[model samples]
Target: MISSCFVTAIQVLILFTLSSPCVRASTFTGSMFEVQISTKLPVKDWVKEAKKDSDPFSLWDPTCFKFVSAIKSVDNQLKEALYTCHSVPGGDENTRLKIYLFIPPERLAPEKQEPCLRAAYKKAFDDWKAGVSANFQIRPEQVQFSCELSV
Candidate 1:
């Protein structure tokens, strides 16, 4: 009888804790970084190709095109990069393209923070270069990439 009562009390306490409004879930701020892709081609040329058809993400791989398009529509800078692409030089003849990406804090798990972020960043970068190479029919190695992280 004592053991039963103890279990019942514990259950009630658990229920009360679970239902408490004062206890809030933890929130995390994800990491944000910019990727710069420098191309010999003009930025205007890239934008023109992107705007050609009903699907503006034609320059991106079909697999990630929709994802990229959704990211593009998230803010006023929607026209930037589909995934936050911006002409860093802000000129017609400039060859610099900057892309912003966020890595959810959950992805930073596995104990090693910096390396995890770098790996994730690299993967996203590889995809971008692949898309760029495909759009221009050039080799992936020819794509110039650099990472920019704001302090």
Candidate 2:
């Protein structure tokens, strides 16, 4: 009973509603970054200085603490996102290493961080949001630093 012109007009209105500014999408990007630097001291002084979730001087010579020479853009100035694990098989594993979570500032304080996070680093995706719920599957080798969806 509806004419073709009326149907076309209704379709146009529906299309406009879906394409309005109120429905704009969020813009953000995330990536898993690994900071790798070697210690030259015979006893690994740099590692001793580096603290978990604590960013320490990249190179140390006793007086002035410095950031990494090559690091340019880091959102986490305090570098408080690093976690250290000694479960690796090496006996001296605890002596010479550090780990850090590099989350971009644009991706920080999101209503939903994970939904906006890189698919590869889903462990941080769900938790970044305030009340979001989801599951995460972390590999056993990376369990110490990852989130498990079930628990």
Candidate 3:
């Protein structure tokens, strides 16, 4: 009887262990910087730049196109979009953007977190670089970006 009880206990423990959620370290990308769009420029111009012939609007996700559409509806002198992408080991952030693509944290494997985050930062940097380049005519390479990670 005791042996049977012990086996049941061990089985229960194994099941519990398997069912438990595993939490891992999370890192935030693009947390240290913000993309500022000049209000002086027309929103249509920005859309046009983003939707250049080489990069058609259709190439972007439908949600991204929606984001750009939403931007068109808003009227502000200076628009700022905070680009913060976090990689949570077992979870995801559902937020999306037209300019900066937010990569969910769950898509990245444990070993590939850093590289994936670096890629995300590069995307954010490139988006900002392109925006300023179109608006202010500044060199894309000259734009600066600083990324930060938080537990």
Best by lDDT: 1
lDDT of 2 by residue, 1-151 (tens): 0010011101111111232466444322222222212222233454455443143332222111222221122232323442221111225322122222334433432343454343423433222211111111222222122221110
- Model 1 poorest 10 in a row by lDDT: 1-10
* Candidate 1: count of backbone clashes, pairs at least 3 residues apart or interchain: 2
lDDT of each: 0.41, 0.25, 0.34
Instruction: TM-score winner between 2 and 3, please give it.
Output: 3
Top-down TM-score ranking = 1, 3, 2
Q: Which stretches of candidate 3 lie over 4 Å from their true place?
A: 1-30, 34-114, 147-151
By summed lDDT, the worst window of 10 consecutive residues in model 2 runs over 1-10
Residue 112 error for model 2, in Å?
8.2
When 2 and 3 are scored with lDDT, the better candidate is 3
TM-score of each: 0.40, 0.19, 0.27
